[model samples]
Target: MEPIQHKIYHVDSFHSRTFLDTYCAKKPEMDLGEECLRLTMEELHYFFKFANIKGGTLIDISIGPIIFHLYSACECFKEIILLRFNDHCIIELKKWLHDRTGAFDWTHALSFVAEKEGISELSEEKDMRLKAAIKHVVKCYDDRENITDPLVLPPADCVLVTNVLDVISKDKVDFIRNLQKFTKLLKPGGQFLLYGALNATYYIVGKDKFHLFNYNENFIRKAIEQEGFVINHCQVRPRKTESDLTDFKAIIFVSAYKN
Candidate 1:
């Protein structure tokens, strides 16, 4: 089947989510829309173990609070860097910290803001494990700049890239090439862990809709090899839900070593 071509959007994630709900949701329930959420999370644990992240730099590029929460529990990296793809997320994050207007409700940002208000209220009885996961994110916020250029990242002992590759640009080849630019920032023999889902939805720069891309693991692995990194481990999984119109699948436990 020919891949679906979604109308591109150049907005930040929040706006894109809004737009997708309005437009893409027009067809059917987005149930099973995100098919591989589980594999992504599962691969995360695998990455930490494979990279020997303890006592290393763990940089989660363009990763939101979820990654922050998980890795913060590790006590692995001497320093953890949470880099966002855009500046708007940084500003929004800060608002959740000091904004008293109580007008804006960015629930996602709360992961990094709840401590400021001591809002134990942020706790969702439904997901206690999640709420207790990354207490550091609730207390501190790291606002770093652009990630389109891999050159910006400092040398990391391990770099965990999740769901970032297929969303950057529609051109997969170029995206892989761009992703390679990050390897130089890794210390010799350092590790890079990448997790991607099959046909995942992501927000991008310029139009107004949630975009979907089927990330090919072979393409990603080959590109990592081209960049002088050795693939350590890689696996993929298809996720299913109760209302299973479609299955969300993902490539997991993919780790590459920079030699």
Candidate 2:
């Protein structure tokens, strides 16, 4: 058998529209969205509201063109900066932010977040707030020592990363290196929230398979602790949707603070 690297495609070759339709669209059947989007949104909403993680700038580094998780975040932070790994993802994000025609409809996700907040009728308002909160959407280079090279960013009050490290990292050491790079974006005592899959080796998007760094909750906890982050809350939910598109055993949500 060949190495895992030879079997999986890089995330840079990902098709944004296909990825969104495959996992984020609201379909009648049980899909990856149930665990990846809805559960993540629910956890983020609860964490932002009760964890005392509010104010200042919030930086978001995520996989694909996902904005569902940011609905609740706009309420807590004054500004949001989105960092993307490639131009395709950046374009997809801008389409939604600018209300372009072919943008993915996020109404379902917005409605779910609104319902959670007890303002089911105010979903549109919530969407508008999220749009207003986003201050910048910039491309970042993972190969560079500074992901945002030539464009230094101020330390943010909060940093949120969702399903990104696992998809991009080549190995455990690469994962830790990327984690530290993201951590450097946070201010002292700043809050950090990470949402990812557990024991996931691969996920499919538009007939293409992308690699995921297989890891467990214990590894995640140890990594964050080693990076000087105090884990405040950590929860793992068993995989609810059984699909060949992804083979993740569980989903993990972690809330921590820079110590």
Candidate 3:
């Protein structure tokens, strides 16, 4: 296997290696493709049950063009908004997805992840097969406007802020704080669906900062509760990894109400 090396950071190299190796061995069908779809639909269903978001508007903070595709197809949204911090994730993402589309292409999207993660072309076949499951369900846009920042998309009925609360490890506290502040963008009584890798430690491809953070159901439920939201349901799943190690579960998905 081609090695994708990073600066010798704080990660437990030995454990990381064994972990990655193990997951690689039993690569399952419910990989990122299945996982993301499951996560997205779960978010959709949650808002439907606890909030009055249907046929209204929707905002996906820190999401991408892919979500617009989802809403467009469902015709369940009055409008769709995609927001992100102004950065290369947007720049490069725009360049890579320069073609216009009304459908979210999961394959191209996952390819971006595979490439961003530095997996060599030689390993593409493996990832491609796993990505195929979800790729078939999504499509994205080519317009640069889709990737712009400080973007206030169409007013939304529900907001999906998934796995974005944890970015830089060193400032994780502040990151969560900022995420809390960001949540105000939602209208009163709007629905907020949150997801995060409770203890994720990965880098933004090519960037030096190691993004890491941890959160459990109780931890997140309490954190968000103070902010005027009531949890309707929550699920914690072992983050899907290519590693075979058995102990590092990394995600919590929360479906909550914004009061």
Candidate 4:
């Protein structure tokens, strides 16, 4: 199948609600809950392990509205900055933080994270902490200019970039270029948390298919090293279910430091 003609930086069809309801939403009848639980554990294990790393500022450069990984770092970092590709994502984030009507509830995921961390509290308590921890949500992308050139923000101690490179890049060169740009946002020796699908060509969202530049562990390691990052931790999980939402044999997580 031909790839999506336009570069998709964020999920377009159902807005943030589409993503929230489809993946992050907690419905008793949903069959994908186990899959979601497994995926969250796979990704959050690294965050939980690396939470003690010295990082006063954290940056998340992910697409869509999911904030599953950020909760782990809330207690470890003083500030959290969310950078997205468009205004839609920014607005979605605001709606949640500001108590706007029609906002997708993320209490289920927040409570899950807190519980995993041994915190005995409702999701609302976690939500308030997360909201206060998040300092800003701004528009950002690495395509128009060098990744380092676009954002004039402070260098982050830890940068979370997940499921971004593959969908936004046209090919390997483009992916590598963007990777280097993202790394430049970090201070030297800062941690770079990354996650992506292995060999996934496309993923569906509300009947719309988005491209994922197929890559493997070898490619990821090479790209990180070439971009001046030292790999400290890595994990891979095999596909848990057969679903058209995404096609990939494995999900890979990497915790690296800027060298």
Candidate 5:
């Protein structure tokens, strides 16, 4: 018998709807959802309130079309510029933003965020607020010298990245290189919030298994520090559920500021 071979992300076909259905769907009993959706929202809510990182522009470079993490962020940042490597993700995001039919339902995630904030606002209102905060969704190429080439983006006050580097980076060097590219988008003294899985080698989207750069907390801390960013708050949550879909040991969130 032969071992199963996984397909590489970016190199292989990735279905946006499949990815959302598998991971971002409203599943209360699933630990994957609890950790990625709920825990991430909770951390961001607290981080924004405590750190007070309000600003004019924020650059978001995250995996897929997941927007749950931004529920709390819309309140803090006036404008959000979303950068994407894939066209499918951009289309899916636009569908939700424009209130098009067949968009992925994120009301459950919104409800959780509202509860955390102790707010009585309906999910529709919160969704509208988030949609308004997002200013643009632009396609990006990682291979280019300037990731956001042609349309030069203004230096942002903050940048938020979630689980993107791990999927795209082939090695530590690639990871650091991509990190540098993202950091260049930030203004001096800008905040960089990163959320990633620790000790993860792969994750499943649909039937395809995509590569993940296996890294731990120390490696991430060192990588960020090497870029001259001052670490502010770092949190790691151990994986609470048993699943064969992914092999990540924990999830990590780090808040840092460029010096």
Candidate 6:
């Protein structure tokens, strides 16, 4: 088998329903939902902790069809833009956002976040807030011309990139370059939130596989700092999923500010 490379980022064959069912299923029977729950909790807690982030623009640079990452953006930002590399993820996002047919239901993830926030029946409320907050879902890519081009995009106060940098980058240098692209999307001193697997080289979506840059906590910190970001918070949780799902050893979260 040949090694997966950066080009896998352009493969727009994401199986939205299959991917969600395989990873986001509530496995109370085997307690397999712990990792998903933990990530949702940590993401929500961090978003709430920075209470000052209310009512601003947020840009979500996503690589997959998963909407769980955007759950907290609804509460923090007045306008949310879901940016992707191709039609696959954007199509799924729009389907959910527009209440169209065959949308991958994000009910379980929203409910999990609601339960963590001590709201038993407010998941629907959260769902509505997210739907309302998301004003646009766009297709975008990270290239020299794309990133270096003048910013025609509305200024964002916060930019969220989750599990995307490594997948799109070929190596550490590429990762840093891509990080610059993300930072450019932000205003001066804007907030930035990132989540990704630590020391991972590959991840799977259904039966198709993709590559990841082998990044460590130290590398992430240095890369962000190089782009003039002040780290506010960082956390890493040991991976708790079955090996077949992913080979990553831990999940890393970082909240920072452009400086």
* Count of backbone collisions within predicted model 2: 0
Q: How close is every model to the real structure, measured as TM-score?
A: 0.61, 0.95, 0.57, 0.89, 0.96, 0.88
User: Which candidate should be chosen as best, given lDDT against the real structure?
Assistant: 5
Error of 4 at 140 (Å): 0.9
- Give lDDT: candidate 3, residue 175: 51
Show model 5 residue runs off by greater than 4 Å: 1-5, 28-31
Misplaced by over 4 Å in model 1 are: 1-39, 46-51, 63-69, 72-74, 95-153, 199-208, 242-248
lDDT for residue 173 in candidate 3, whole number 0-100: 57
Single out the weakest 10-residue window by summed lDDT for candidate 4: 6-15
The number of clashing residue pairs in each candidate reads: 9, 0, 15, 0, 0, 0
Better of 2 and 5 by lDDT: 5
Residue 227, model 4, lDDT: 77
Tens digits of per-residue lDDT for model 4, 126-190: 77887899998887756556442454888899888878777777688878888877887888889
Clash pairs of candidate 6?
A: none
Tens-place lDDT per residue, model 1, 36-131, is: 332343345454545455644666654332332342324455555555554444444344334445323434333333443245666643133333
Q: After superposition, which runs of candidate 6 have C-alpha atoms over 4 Å from their true positions?
A: 1-7, 27-32, 147-151
Those runs of model 3 whose alpha carbons end farther than 4 Å from true positions after fitting are 1-32, 36-52, 63-74, 92-155, 168-172, 203-209, 244-248
Output the lDDT of residue 254, model 1: 69
lDDT of each: 0.48, 0.87, 0.46, 0.75, 0.89, 0.74
Error of 5 at 70 (Å): 0.6
Q: List the residue pairs that clash in candidate 1.
A: 9-205, 9-206, 9-207, 10-205, 10-206, 10-207, 35-248, 36-248, 235-252
| Residue 251's lDDT in candidate 4 | 78
lDDT of 3: 0.46
Give lDDT tens digits, candidate 3, residues 6-45.
3222232222222222222224542454344544444444
Ranking of all predicted structures according to lDDT, beginning with the best and ending with the worst: 5, 2, 4, 6, 1, 3
